[model samples]
Target: MSNELPTVALVRLLEGARYEVMPTASVVDAVGEHVPPSVTVTVTAAPGKGLEATLSTATTLARAGWPVVPHLAARMLTGRGELQEVVARLAEAGVTAAFVPGGDADPPAGDYDCALDLLRDLATMEHPFTQVGITGYPESHPTIDDDVTVQAMWDKRAYATHIVSNMTFDAEHLGTWCERVRRRRVELPLLVGVPGPVERTKLLGMATKIGVGESLRFLRKQKSVFARIAAPGFSSDRFVSRVAALSANPALGIAGLHVFTFNQVGVVETWRQGMLARAREERVHPTGRGGHQDG
Candidate 1:
């Protein structure tokens, strides 16, 4: 059992679980209560309402003592001055990491159109972070062409410290994508992304509100492949279990799980704790190789 601990013991070592939350509701209250004090919590604000919203959320979270990582959506930044201001404000709040993405905003406000551009701008400003996370698409992006997306990632690798995969449901696809990343020499550590502990009803509501429902409907008109997309978005215990399967392999270079909590922080925290306890128990009593049965 002592020897078995190393195989499964890591399951309980989630001292700094990372959670992504939207700026809705009383986020600080939720963070203070449900989120463990040791964990890092990120709040995201997209392009519509602008960078002010993101900075406000970042400020509040920093004051609350969570290591805050705000998403610096490329399209949202208006110009070099705005970008500099954002970096300065974040630095003031003690933010060390930022996830840059080519945001979904229509009509770019500045010269930057994609995350790569933003990365370049930030580099020129000499404002490097302790961690810079760039998005990776294991599953195809709805808007970008596959070839362009992969090339964009390779080009951005030098500026990023890690790659956080966008939402992916298929474990096999994720594994394959990881192999492709290695084959391409994109050496940044990966943080597997998945939805967290959201109820089906809530997920559906969010999807509808965010217009993902319309996108899926459009896809359905094109091909039967859209059937999978028809289902409401929600986290799968099965998916988490599958990802956990890779825990023992250092060669995988997986940093950890990145949960897009969608402000369902309380629920995911409980789920994380339960999984940790189960894995800890498995460690006490030896589990099969890879803990496949335990999962």
Candidate 2:
């Protein structure tokens, strides 16, 4: 294991680094300006905006020569017919990857209530998608129990190509969870969710609205979520630095860092560039002081 873990993590992070974007139209320009075409981009779905918003954003990104993965929220689709239409649209737009999430919708619009149910339907389709991603909750889920989350991962193993973990600040918790997942014999590559340089104020509001909000509520009931968010400034530095330690072990199958930019691509991109530059300087001058630099 290297004594300087972040150095190694930086390389892994930049390799096929994923930036998640929402359906907002302005995001297309923001992502184009900040995110490199080399990095994979993911489009998130919102119940209010509908799945078309996500698909259109993804299609635009794909057309712009960016590899995009759109979120297929099971609750949003009407039925298998809708799924096929979506698959066709994605195929036509050149999006070969997708992320399947159970979604936060209270009342599902279709027969597919969960991601697994959607995955089962997708398997029946002769779609063009080559890579399918499923969500993973390293920490306890907001709605589902820990055991259920684990079982869900196992159930979707056949359909999903990889697992993208939800937000978790604790590296120890993530590492331990990965170990347990391996113990269960599900060896799919795991993409750990790492937040970029997003503002605390902006995050609190958005987090409360996204699935992160539910997780926050669950954490609050357990009496551990308030302290962290209440603290003024927030950065991915500490969390990413800690997670760097896990890269030392290849058996963990930690594929790469999937950054939750939350559509704050400008700041996140600046932070990523600064980190890469810092890593380079550190390689040349190992003894120099290197503090956390997140814009």
Candidate 3:
């Protein structure tokens, strides 16, 4: 049995598949411990807060020699001139990509109501980013109608380089959504969202502090049926495996995993390394010549 891990193969998988590995300022040190310098880490500004905070996080991380992508939430910018300043700061820090979500910011700061609107504004900017990622909902959004969500994606397609799915736990639903995106002619590569390797207790703590429980409620309400999230743990292993399986399917066009590290960077990195090791070993084992050993 060949238990050797293929470094090149895994590197390609990581590079091709991953969208954003989110790391918060509170856990910036943890990011240094876990995330490889090769992967881009996206630092998020608290929604509705000004771009200064997000830019600061991105600047710090970029200075640390890590490729950093800042989330430029829609409601954060004051105007076109403010947008230019934000872009200039990001460019100065060597950030080539950013994630723009219709921020939860109430009453909006400027003209943009949603991500699509922000994308429109960004397209007109002189310093347009080479790579811009937009949110995709495999599950229905809490407040938005399904038809509207679909239409919004179509509208943003020209501005977006990739689609990063919002966090959804159901793999079957995710697979189906990938098909839907393809059917709708959404050719942008997808980064399947998965919760990271945080234990249930700790995740609950962070979720409460970060208002994630409310977000989870929003997701559950959008789902066809409510699910009691399986007990005592959060792991991206199954989520990553489901995504890797989809890589064999030519039609879905799954690009990679976007781990919602939720500030649990160290544990998530450990989980990824372990799975990649197992996957590599399984691929080489003589006993399982044609079978997926990881399964």
Expressed as tens digits, the lDDT of each residue in 1-295 for candidate 2 is 2343555665555555789877775789988888889888999887767788898899999999999999999998888999999999989988999999998666899798899999999998799888999998886876689999999999999998999998777788899999999999999998898777676565565555445645464345433334454355444666675666576577788878888876888888887777767655655566444433342
Name the top TM-score candidate. Answer: 2
Q: Which is the leading candidate under lDDT? A: 2
Clashes per model (N, Cα, C within 3 A)? 0, 0, 2
Off by over 4 Å in 3: 1-25, 48-50, 208-235, 286-295
Query: What overall lDDT goes with each candidate model?
Result: 0.71, 0.79, 0.67
Model 1 ranges with Cα > 4 A deviation: 1-16, 126-128, 207-235, 287-295
**Which should have the higher lDDT, number 1 or number 2?**
2
Q: CA RMSD for every model? A: 4.4, 3.9, 4.7
| Model 1 whole-model lDDT (C-alpha atoms) | 0.71
Q: Residue 183 lDDT in model 2?
A: 97
